[model samples]
Target: MSTLQDSGEKPSIYLHRLQVALSVTIKRGGISPEKADQHLLKQFCRGCWDNSLIADLQLEQKKMNPPSFAELLLLLRTEEDKCTAKATRMKQHLGASKQRVLSHSQRAWMSSESEPDVETTETTPSQEQRKSSSAISQPRTTTSKTQRGKPKPWYCFTCGEDGHIASACDNEPNSVLVTTKRKQLKEKQRLWESQNPSADQSPHMAFIQTNGL
Candidate 1:
């Protein structure tokens, strides 16, 4: 006697009870006759209950005029599109404002640090003036003291004597010149040794050989 609109039991709860009764009726058909007849009564009771519940739900839905599945889906899609458009426009506006602010800041900085322009002439000078300027800019030449004194004698490998081969320049200190000249000689010696490994042995080997000798 439990109707779908019974205040004590909710419609969903009543439906659940009905489904259980139908299951029990189907299960009892394989059992004794008395149990089968009792299960058949339960089945009829469950069916009537389910039909009444469904009818009540349909009547409630008609009163409310709820949206169809397709209409609900389209509404959701329209709302999503509107949200996306609004977000895009907001982003664009923010970007434009940022660019404007940056431009204005740059312009203000430029105005504060503005520099004045310098002027230059394009006229040319005369050739004589140019020559004189070039002459002034040229490097000065150094002259040796050979003309003021007697000509110094040159030294030769075959002979050595005063006022002849090596004595005329005996007053000059040659050690400084020798030291300055050693850089080129050292470079040549290194190149020769690299090209001819057995030509000039290392200083250690030379020392050992000389000591033995």
Candidate 2:
């Protein structure tokens, strides 16, 4: 039943529900608030039937004259276009900023992965130089030791050692005596040769003298 205006008014719940339903129907119909005939169009538009607010609308209709619905809707659509363009620009700015942050993060990650944080032992120039010097000195030290350890020839006169005469007894120095003995032996050989001139002749020599000469 239609409630009387003198009966105080509709319940708050009923009015709230009615407004919600009207708003939903208006949006679904794409009817901008500008085109809505706040007076004559009390029911939800777009063929949705509702007569609950007919009396209230009639009272509101007597209050004022609104602009043409179609023209007002056109103005409303233009305003919406401006709002949509502003939203699109804001979205693009947000996307570009997000991409920039992501790129910086990825570059940092790759650098960390490529060059790891490993600890290494570092050698100073002095240490390296000392190592090289030790390497070079090793071979010279070995060569000196080899030369010092080399064996000399054994020359013992009692055992008739290598390259030893009777004068080199017990490895004593007899250089003067050896030279004197050598000179005496040479003189003896010369005297013997003068005493026996034909003593050195062989059988072959005798034969050659008797036959050929």
Candidate 3:
């Protein structure tokens, strides 16, 4: 069932196929009938690719005691029926509105010679649009997790380029400015490293390790 793709199949038909598969699995001694409900529920959910459908079942899925396979199928069938009915009503409303417009246009054309006021008490397009759009089901809103975007790039102070520091930069290193800076750094380290060891102070960890510990 996890391999089953939606392929534009209706929920009812999908559930039917799932039911048949579960039955076959049970008859083949693949799964015990006692645990078939749980297996069936999982396989059904795995087969559903629609986020909205999954969202609709989240409440049931999160329950302390999850709904049975039969209950899930029944709920899915009800949802499918509701969606079909709403779609049918929306089509009927749109067709009626179109017919009304065509009828009005024909009448106006017939009386084109004599101009007369045509009263329009028809609902506005916005109203009809809202009415038609209301048919779509709204999925449950889930809070999104905090996502870290591409990590802030490294800033190079030497060349002011991103993604690298001065040490890692691959630009020309023989420049006078770079040579002078490196000389100054090495001189400072040499002076520090050459200082005599104080009697009261402890030796450096590296010096101790280099010696007999």
Candidate 4:
């Protein structure tokens, strides 16, 4: 009997022993009597007499039961192959997806790079041409006769003459006949107030008197 301490094996060896013992117990009592017999036979071939030989003996016993061992190993191998195939397929699919995404991004970048940028072009004529054109067009405009090299006459509002405006007119009736009658009235009031110094009235009182309050 090889002790774990003597063999310098890990403590896990003890755990493995416990697992084997439990497995044997469950096998012998967990099933029908006939199944227990088969289990016992199986254990004998497995050489599971002690913990030290458990793993190696189990492999040997499985070989002795060739049909069952082959079937179980084949199934496990097939399942592992299937898992490997699935993992490979998934990795390839992801790679293709990434390539497609990168291709699309590159195409978009290229399209933007290939596009032409539009710019506005401004062209202004020379200053001399602009000045000449302005000078040529100015004389074509019509000017008033009085403003065309002739002094304008002042019109008298009283007699409809052209000597002086109503303000400078000597005739009182002519001043009253001015086109700006309101201005003429204000000027007349100002003159009257200047001549008469005795007029003493507040603006509010004047407003009330005018309104007949």
Model 4 score (lDDT): 0.36
Top model number, TM-score: 3
TM-score of each: 0.17, 0.19, 0.40, 0.18
**On a 0 to 100 scale, what is the lDDT of residue 195 in model 2?**
53
User: Which parts of model 1 are misplaced by more than 4 Å?
Assistant: 1-63, 96-213
Q: List, residue by residue over 26-137, the lDDT tens digit for candidate 1.
A: 4456444334334433433443333433343342333234433223223334543553454455436654334334333222212222211121124565787667655643
For residues 59-155, could you state the per-residue lDDT of candidate 3 as single tens digits? 3364445565546656777776665565455436655444345443322212222122232337665776655544431211110111111111123
- As for lDDT, the candidate ahead, 1 or 4, is 4
Better of 1 and 2 by TM-score: 2
Q: Which ten residues in a row have the lowest lDDT in candidate 4?
A: 144-153
Highest lDDT model number:
3
Q: Using TM-score as the measure, what is the rank order of every candidate, best first?
A: 3, 2, 4, 1
Question: Of the candidates numbered 1 and 2, which has the greater lDDT value?
Answer: 2
Please identify model 4 stretches exceeding 4 Å from their true place: 1-23, 26-28, 32-70, 96-213
TM-score of model 2 vs. true structure:
0.19
Ranked by lDDT, top first: 3, 4, 2, 1
lDDT value, candidate 2, whole model:
0.36
* Candidate 1 steric clashes: 0
Better of 1 and 3 by lDDT: 3
Clashing residue pairs in candidate 2 are none
Clashing pairs in 1: none
